[model samples]
Target chain A: MTIRYPNGKKYVPVRTSKSQKLKNPSFSNRGKSLEDELNESNDYYLSRGIAVIHKKPVPVQVVKVSYPARSAARITEAYFGTPSTTDYNGVWKGIYVDFEAKETKIKTSFPLNNIKEHQIQHMQNVTNAGGFAFLIIKFTTLERYFIVPFEMVERKWDRMKAGGRKSITLLEFENTSVEVQPGYIPRLDYLNAVETLMKLYDDKIER
Target chain B: MTIRYPNGKKYVPVRTSKSQKLKNPSFSNRGKSLEDELNESNDYYLSRGIAVIHKKPVPVQVVKVSYPARSAARITEAYFGTPSTTDYNGVWKGIYVDFEAKETKIKTSFPLNNIKEHQIQHMQNVTNAGGFAFLIIKFTTLERYFIVPFEMVERKWDRMKAGGRKSITLLEFENTSVEVQPGYIPRLDYLNAVETLMKLYDDKIER
Candidate 1:
């Protein structure tokens, strides 16, 4: 069975290949998708009682459905709806946390076009409302993930809108964004970066 | 077009009656559903820069989909998945706000069975994390709405689990819950109740 979005893009299930499986028998999810890793990390966070965060489900506008059984209704026609906010959001340490995660194959630069204008506006609103807002960008080729604060993104977005570079280069991203190392159990330990950013934000407020 | 959930309930769009329409031509959504009212109130809140809240989209597990055109793909088979958390959550005045909304026709008492165990647990978790968590209960017959804090519900849930009454009486609810009157523009001005709760919470913390 296969699932496709309204845009006709096939939804590929995250799975390990036979060759990769054979090479790394002990590590099954070594090459799993970014979403899978983040989900595992969130589960780890929840289990340990550290934080409660969840990825918002993909919004779908269902037009038709059929009830074959009392407990099994099948959606026959649905259209994907545009998300008004980011993908992930939850409460952390008495504060609201909101962010969007994206992966790119390009190693040179992270394209700003990957994020929508409404998302940036939403992040701005969150920040203004005294919540933590950021982006989790993953460079698939380099296998590196970084937490880019909304302020950094806002600056870059404004620069781009003012006829500057459309994308932030690898060096610029490395300097501005906080890199998060992947781990075995949690997979992507992004909260450490959040903790660091929170301290920095607090320090700035004090100054 | 009709959409059915896995529980065999058809999704009905909220519509005003012909008589209601004729009686109040100025008021378009006079007899809209609870969900519709909530959505409109959320929109009002967002537009006014008061808060940012959204109802989580219904989660569905898609089994099969077909692409009829490049721009449009239709889900042929899917099933509704159980939500792990409440329907609505967002940031308000630098605090995390989370709540579940339910409507009941029973005028004497509100049934505890309307709320799931996981939802109760989730609300507990939110409150523990220093976030605001509550339930918006609407008694359809009485045409009254109340914001019942998780602490109140938790107390009742515990007593019920210990072999007490399975429902909370209307008098008890009236005494414990913060009543919120319905309005025309926002329909359900829930945040007014939230504001009062916040002050009470702050006062308790100060003490």
Candidate 2:
């Protein structure tokens, strides 16, 4: 039941070593999967009646299957299908919250290639629909996470297409994005940053 | 791959034949899949900048896979996983929209067994979050569709569990639920029915 990445790399669940944990107890979950942490945070929010966000399941096209005696049916042939939207979405304080999360080992910059074109378009649609859309990006090496609103990302995305840098520098990300500090129970509490964006939206409406 | 229902019945994509088409021009998509129609309607809304609804992909647990070519990889073994949430959700008119769609061939009543317990709980969660949640049910035999809000459905669900009727009669459904007349371009035109519910919500808020 091993799942590999599309690039043929073995999908390993990152775990902090005992020595590393001892060295930095605060960042014990430094190398762990951002997706897993986000799922945990979502569960925490759901339990506390905070939000109802969920990660969309991976799309696959099944071509063949088999049924063994006294066993469950198994798909024998399938291929990954392109997703039409972003990863996570739900209702937060009666607001539609839509977002995508990604982690990169590189410390200097976050590559735009990590994101797909359709996902960007989907975020734009969410924004146009008056939904809160953003990206939760994690720098694995730096053990930092930030929430970048769709508007900011769209500006940089458009810039990249017009003979600009292929990636967003760490300096630029730190300046434009809201830094989300990791926590024990929720793991990655990005909602706090969402509240800030909510205030900004409210203020805009007031003006 | 061939898919089968939990009851061991093969999953067949319903299609309207020439004879059926000739019989009912309005119900031209009589036997076609409801999921496909919903997808088309979602696409229509997306293109027109109306709403941003999407169907969540079916979750599958991959057990084994093989790389046949340098670029193409095939899943050799997998199994369908139970979904944690409903099939479709998005933002509509600054409101969180969540729903599950089902089609039944029975003419008299709609079976409660068509929906799982978790799905009911999920819909309740959506409602509690101040989001719009409902079911798009199609009675295939009569070619009739209805949007049953979670509150009404929840009452019936609780009643069934307390030794009440195991199914909702067509008479009850027609009276309680919002009837959605099918259209040409979007096909389902369920949003029009949604507007009725929206008005009811707005009136309640004013009071």
Candidate 3:
């Protein structure tokens, strides 16, 4: 089944090789999507009282509905609505956490087009409010994940707007972004990186 | 038109009498529902950079969808899902804000059944994380609104669990909760009450 996004983009499923699955038979997220893994991570965080993050429901505009005499109301027609904000947001240790997760198959660079303009604006808003905002960049093919801070994103976005490089290089990611290793309970374990980000902010304040 | 909630409860729209509308002709929200007013207030806050709050979309589980030949994909089958968390939450002035808005025609007491068990749990999680959590209770018939802190609600909930009163009386509300007066730019200015709540917390820490 194919699910179309608000922009009419078809949701593509990431395929895992049989050999790769067999090689990592013990892991739970062998063939799972980034979104699914992140959700599982959130569940782990919630169950342990570590965080209260949640993914917002996909925005859909219901155009028509029919109520059967003895049954529940059935939605007859609906269209996906463009998201005005990022997917995940919640509080962690008295600090606000907001971030967007995007999986890219490209290994050399992470494209700027993966995030929308308004989404960047929303992240900027969160950061301006003293909240921690970042991007969870999942290199699906490379089996790597990095938590790219919004400040870095904003700088690149500004440069891109001025006709500079259209994407951030892997070298840049290695140098600036905090890498998160995949694990068992919390599939992604991105909060460790978040803690690092928080410390960086604290150090800046102290300075 | 009626929209059923995930629990199969039909959404009842607040009806405004013609005389009442005439009496409050100058107000933009004369015939508006509490949800509408709250959304407008959030918009006002967002535009002014005061805060970034948003009402989560109604949760719907899409069972089936059809991709038309030329037009957009249409959801042919879906069911409303019970909300796992409160309707609204966001960041405000470096603080995390979480809340649920509820309206009642009954002026004597605010029914406890309006909030669910998991929702209370969600608010408790927010408070435990050192985030701000509250309820925007609108007494439609009495034209009164209150910002009821989670602490007050928690006390009442525990009392109810032990076979005490299931509802909070208007007298109790007036004594404990912060009253929010309706206005033009922002229909219900509950953030001012939230500021008061933050001050209360600061004072407690200082003490």
Best by lDDT: 3
Candidate 2 collision pairs: A63-B1
Off by over 4 Å in 2: A1-27, A201-207, B1-27, B201-207
- lDDT minimum window of 10 residues, candidate 1 chain A: A20-29
lDDT of 3 by residue, B1-207 (tens): 779989999987553577675434444546678899999999998888988999998888899999999988888888777888999999877788899999887879999999899999999888777678999998887788998988898899999999999999999988888899899888778899878866764332221
- Model 1 misplaced stretches (Cα beyond 4 Å): A1-29, A202-207, B1-29, B201-207
True contacts kept of each: 0.67, 0.80, 0.67
Please provide, for model 2 over A1-207, each residue's C-alpha lDDT reduced to its tens digit, 9 standing for 90 to 100. 988999999998654476555333354574458888999999998998888999998899989878989988888889888898998999876788899999887889999999999999999898787688899988876788988878878888999999898898889877888898888998988998878766754331221
The C-alpha lDDT values of all candidates are 0.82, 0.84, 0.84
- Report clashes for each candidate as comma-separated counts: 0, 1, 0
Tell me the spans in candidate 3 whose CA falls farther than 4 Å from its real position. A1-28, A201-207, B1-28, B201-207
Model 1 chain B weakest lDDT span, ten residues long = B20-29
Residue A133 lDDT, candidate 1, scale 0-100: 92
Residue-level lDDT tens digits of model 1 in B24-68:
333443556678889999999888888889999999888888888
Write model 1 residue lDDT over A64-171, tens digit each, in one string. 988886667878888778899999999866778899999887889999999999999898888776678999998876777898888988999999999998998889
TM-score of predicted model 3? 0.86
By descending TM-score, how would the candidates be arranged? 2, 3, 1
